[model samples]
Target chain A: MQNTALLTVENLCVEIPTRRGILKPVDDVSLQIAPGEILGVVGESGAGKSMTGNAVIGLLDPPAHISGGQVLLNGKRVDNLPREQMRRVRGKQIGMVFQDPLTSLNPLLPIGDQLVETIQEHLPVSQREARDRAVAALDEVGIPAASSRIDSYPHEFSGGMRQRVVIALALCAEPDLVIADEPTTALDVSVQAQIISLLKKLCRERGTGVMLVTHDMGVIAEASDRVAVMYAGRLAEIGPVRQVLTDPQHPYTAGLMGSTPGASLGRRRLNQIPGTMPGLNAVPDGCAYHPRCPRAEAKCRAEPRPPVSGSASCWFPGEVKI
Target chain B: MSALVKIAGLTRIFDVSKPWLNRLLERRPKAFLKAVSDVDLQIEERTVYALVGESGSGKSTIGKVVVGLLAPSEGSVEIEGVDLHRETDAAKVDHVRSDIQMIFQSPFASLNPRWKVRDIIAEPVAARGGDTKGLSERLLEQVGLAAGDADKFPHEFSGGQRQRICIARALASNPKLIVCDEPTSALDVSVQAQVLNLMSDLQEDLGLTYLFITHDLTVVQHMADTVGVLYLGRLVEEAPRDALFERARHPYTQMLFEAAPRIDAFGREVDPPKGEIPDPINPPSGCAFHPRCPLAIERCTRERPEMRQLGPARVACHMAEP
Candidate 1:
């Protein structure tokens, strides 16, 4: 707690008491983001990437509760922060920009107004001062005509611009950490690049540690300092970005990388993992990815603990090669 | 080479967003949003031509028009030299349509929930006056699905399998040209790779020409022989896959490349792709992308640049020569 890791999650677990029984979407998971560094949490849909983000922000829907573990922001326990305290911490200390900029932004309000309101809420700044700060934030993100476009509504702006506005809103308060959950997923490839660049640029300039969650491996490789691969709500692998992506130790992580169309072509086709993600309600008895893992054996049937080698969960991760 | 498909100046204007009450009260201006604007492209026999753009960029609209879902306002659509909407007879229309088929985005929605996979795949064959004997078993196997999968409901199958059933249905018609509109975007990345690989394999076996439409650059990299970039109802750049990837001339294209997170390069700060694509109804004067262009010149503000050949790429940008 005394160390300045910026944010740390230790064996975080959340449960939903459904009609059937207690179900866990995010199992025992632990990760960290250092000050000014970027941590990428990646997985497919229902892999708990968004769930983890939502849990961190206290925005989890009803019936969902943080059952066990601890979350530390700035070395302070934040798992059970009160609603009012959490609300204050949300925009001031840890900002968020969602996947769809259009939905995240209030389409009825002008972009400038939204940013100004966001800035003024956390800080005791007048509308004029907030507007000035908004323009400055927009400019910092490389948006053109920061002065004029500020007055335009979200509909008037393009997808990339709208995302920039969301970024400006998130950063105008100058938070210590920004949780961008699939920030560029909704934009075009070229525009997706711009938003990713802008997010990385601002985080770098302001020394804002970022928790970037996305499904794209390319984004993780390009933007993240560290990478965490989640499977069935658990962290299958976590390491240096290049180490985890290029030479994955965990079979789940390796399968994910192999499944990507652009990664390798000598195999002729994606090395398919035999099956799809299991339904969230049915928890696997042992290694969650055993169904799709190619190298699974009898040992895989026994519930495996988190691998000690470079932070992975596996039954037979013999040695740390990297 | 005999082209399998040809699109010349394809344009479709839709007046959405105007309510009935608003239209009755005041003389509401006919808001024409050019969903698919002027464009020229050719699909060579058995080759895949990919059109890539974000939502509202008219890539899907063009697919819709090609499949006669919507008729183009100002351009012509030809399938093997037969026009879709000529003042011609029904025999010609039937003949033209028989050679063209389309695969939709969501397999869950596209494949009826109540129907078994066998009936779903056989519907197109029944419609197109094709043989249905042993079709389901063969097509299912081709897509890597078991023959027993044909007896199950769509809900029983995974997304990838459901999409395979959709592919089987599309194949039922045995079209020379298939317009695939973001077919894999709704599935997981791993599943997407499987489906894409399957599509490529199917193409190879059937000698099918694919007009693959997607916003994901990775998918384009895997499936496209030629790539076209669209922005606000216009085709901004067209080039061979490698040429487009290596030598994109359009500022928007350049920005797009920079914005997308890539796999090989990790841990670098990226900028926003480019400015947002403007509204097609009231697009920016001169170049549609001028307002957001990082290298916008004076010429970009005054007159719209026509698509011109530069190097091996065809680009619509005043900055192309530079």
Candidate 2:
């Protein structure tokens, strides 16, 4: 199963050159997603969750580029591929669902046209066949009356429906991997559940790998098979969802679990980690989390802790009582 | 305990229809969206009253109305027994206005980009003709920021810190009630924990009341003393936090609780909430949630359920029992 991983990121480092200095937004991150498995990358805003996702999909904008390591899709290194080739790989092999569906989609075009265009661009299908597949894709994502709804413009549909349409667009070409960055964050709770289940079902049926990037631990707990916790551009913890959430080996992971209201019952005050996450430029020496970590010691600030044999990167691995 | 804030039969309607010429050309009637419908709430002093609902449920609309940002099309809002809309005396209205402050969801959008942190926090105090000298510095310290950091701009701080600044600005007015509309939704879990802890601490130290609005059930559980479940502009259930969480009386409330993914709840397969929230413009007859409610009965389709006391909870569902 490990050898047959669908997507792999090995010691990936992304750097953004600014006037002040070179900001390593993503540093030495490594993870793998098996076929038909969902790997949830959980972190705060500056933790480089989206940056990792963008790096995987070759969507990193200018001034920011992968400085080290490699991204392998189906055993082929795609990170160093040419621009046009990478663009081709995006729609054909790896699909993406961003946070906002409106911005991802073209408002001027109808849903049907967009779907058909993407299908035709990626696959060697005729316009008629692409339209049929487009309708089928919409229906697969639980859009009611897909045949009729396909003609509607984006604004005509509600927020939830537009999101479903976005999902359909992502999966219409039948990509092997889907990187959804906070896909359900913009949705309502009920709709969020629907979209989550829909994504899981569609991916399972198609045997597709998924990289689910979100800050919500609940979503991570619900949708992910394996979870990766990132802190200040580094991997803090990566393991099975159950183990990472229930028995977090890293202090950061433990703090996150303890702080989540969903993880605790009653009105107990959350166990807060002191101070905010350091920016890319100001990320401290040794452990990025040492400044705010409850279990931080002199050793933690003196040397960067390497990942334990299993997954956690911490000076002291195992649960720390809060 | 006497209510610090009273919202009686609050109703807000938005004219979302096409223009007269467009409607005439399209041969369609005018459309009015009933955003909030006959909502009643009594928020006690030093307590948090949370309104939890999906989008279009009018939770934010109610919060806006309570904070006097949006005027209700009908009904009354009373702060300290003075009707904000109906108070004829200028002095009484001013007094009521000064007692209320609001913190918006987006910290980035809420703070002006050009203004320094000092000027931003002092704006509220200055508006009321109060001396702004050293007010921002004091508030920055109170909200867990350095007094000297007031010289910086909003963009200089992280999202969590920006939210802290927003809280400081809200506190600058020395208001008795603060309306927080999805305050931490945009934040990460760890940062969200910090902000939530800060809010809780502030509430205890300052004896402040909060009209908290959010869609996250877990946050509601942690922050709210009393929780109100809204569906299609109607309050379907209102109960003390423990009562609501343990025994959600209304079907919609139950569905929301079940559909929401919980970090503590592992290995449990979440059933996606059935059906979507009905269009607010043409809501279903009777209970708005009846169309999607699993326990909905024939009575639920024809006649709307009135809010009735059921043990510790107030529910508007025919099938719900004490």
What is model 2's DockQ versus the real complex? 0.70
Q: Write candidate 1's Cα lDDT for B29-129 as tens digits.
A: 65778787788887889899999877778999899988888988998988878887873878888877877788999987898898888888888787667
Model 2: per-residue lDDT, tens digit, B1-322? 8899988999999999898999999999989999999999899999999999998899999998988888999999899999888889999999889889999999999999999999999999898789999999999999999999999999889899999999999999899999999999988788898999999999999999999999998899999999999999999999999988888899998888888987865546778888888889999998888889888889999999999999999999899999
**With candidate 2 superimposed using the best TM-score fit, by how many Å does residue A174's alpha carbon deviate from the native?**
2.0
Query: Which stretches of candidate 2 lie above 4 Å from their native place?
Result: none
What's the C-alpha lDDT at position B61 in model 1? 89
Residue pairs in clash, model 1: A190-B256, A193-B259, A193-B260, A194-B259, A194-B272, A194-B273, A195-B272, A197-B270, A197-B271, A221-B266
Error of 1 at A273 (Å): 2.4
Best by lDDT: 2
Docking quality class, candidate 2: medium
lDDT of model 1 at residue B12? 88
Over A1-322, each residue of candidate 2 has an lDDT whose tens digit, in order, gives 4479999899999999999999999999999999899999999888999999999999999899999999999999999999999989997899999999899999999999999999999999999999999999999988899999899999998888899999999998889999999999888888898898888898889999999999989999989999999999999999999989888889889888888887776655898888888878798888888898878889888765555547799878894854
- Model 1 accuracy (lDDT, Cα): 0.83
TM-score of chain B of each: 0.95, 0.99
